[model samples]
Target: ELEALADPMRKDVSVVRKRIDVVNKELKPLGTNVQKKEKEYKDALDAFNEKNKEKVQLINKLVELVGESERLRMKKLEELSKSVDSMQ
Candidate 1:
């Protein structure tokens, strides 16, 4: 009777070990796939940040150019007004 009980218990343990090995085999590839996806996400985020920085720089330069153009136009207007006043 003892021998019969021990044999079943051993078989159960062997089944459990096989199941664990199968799960581990499946889990390794899943872990590697997760890592690859994480790297891809990080790379995309980095590229987006770099493009945003460049966009900000271009906008700043545009604002500066607009301000300079306005200032020059106002100066020219003042010169024209002064000349008109002198002619009268």
Candidate 2:
């Protein structure tokens, strides 16, 4: 009804008020927790970025080593072919 919509009841209002009070009470500690978690996340990201740079450098070095290995393999195959041709 319109009366229910306009006022509802004091008990309903009181319940909503109590819930709001409880939420406000919980928010203070939750705020500190959020700040602590945010700092930890930022520190972790910084550390990960530092370590990621090292990983990228190592990967580049590994790629160079692989290229050198391929070059060596081609040279060895060429030498083998030359030897086989000489035998023929």
Candidate 3:
């Protein structure tokens, strides 16, 4: 009676081990694909951040250029006003 019980239990354990092996084989490729996708996402994010930084720098330069232009125009207006006052 004990022998018969041990035999079936041994078979069940073997079957379970084989199923686990098959599942592990399937998971191996899935893990590799997940890693590949993660790397791609990271690369795309890096590129997007780099482009955003460049855009911000360009906007800052534009603001500086506009400010300088306005300052020069105001200085010119002041000089013209002084010339008109001297003439008067």
Candidate 4:
């Protein structure tokens, strides 16, 4: 009677082990695909960040140029005002 009970339990364990092996085999390729997709996502994110940095640098340079232009315009206006006052 003990042998009979043990026999069934051994068969159940064997069946479970076989199912586990099949599941592991199926998961291998899926795991590889997940890793590949993760790498691609990381690379795209890096590129986007780099582009944003370049855009910020360009904007800063534009701001500097605009400030310089305004300063030069004010200086030219002051010179013209002095010339006009002299003629009065």
Candidate 1 per-residue lDDT over residues 5-24, each given as its tens digit: 76868878889999999999
In TM-score terms, which candidate is top? Answer: 4
Give the distance in Å from residue 67's predicted Cα in candidate 2 to where it truly belongs. 0.9
Q: How far out, in Å, is residue 16 in model 3? A: 1.6
The C-alpha local distance difference test score for the whole of candidate 3 amounts to: 0.97
Superposed Cα deviation of residue 65, candidate 1 (Å): 0.7
Q: Each model's number of backbone clashes?
A: 0, 0, 0, 0
RMSD after CA superposition, every candidate: 1.9, 6.4, 2.0, 1.8
lDDT of each: 0.97, 0.97, 0.97, 0.97
Which residue pairs collide in model 3, if any?
none
Show where candidate 3 strays beyond 4 Å. Answer: 1-3
Tell me the lDDT of model 4 at 17: 100
Lowest-sum lDDT 10-residue window in model 4: 3-12
How many backbone overlaps does candidate 1 show? Answer: 0
What is the per-residue lDDT of model 2 for residues 1-88, given as tens digits with 9 covering 90 to 100?
A: 8877788796788999999999999999999999999999999999999999999999999999999999999999999999999999
Per-residue lDDT tens digits for candidate 3, residues 2-85, read 988768688788899999999999999999999999999999999999999999999999999999999999999999999999
Candidate 1 ranges with C-alpha deviation above 4 Å: 4-11
Query: Per-residue CA lDDT of candidate 4, range 37-88, in tens?
Result: 9999999999999999999999999999999999999999999999999999
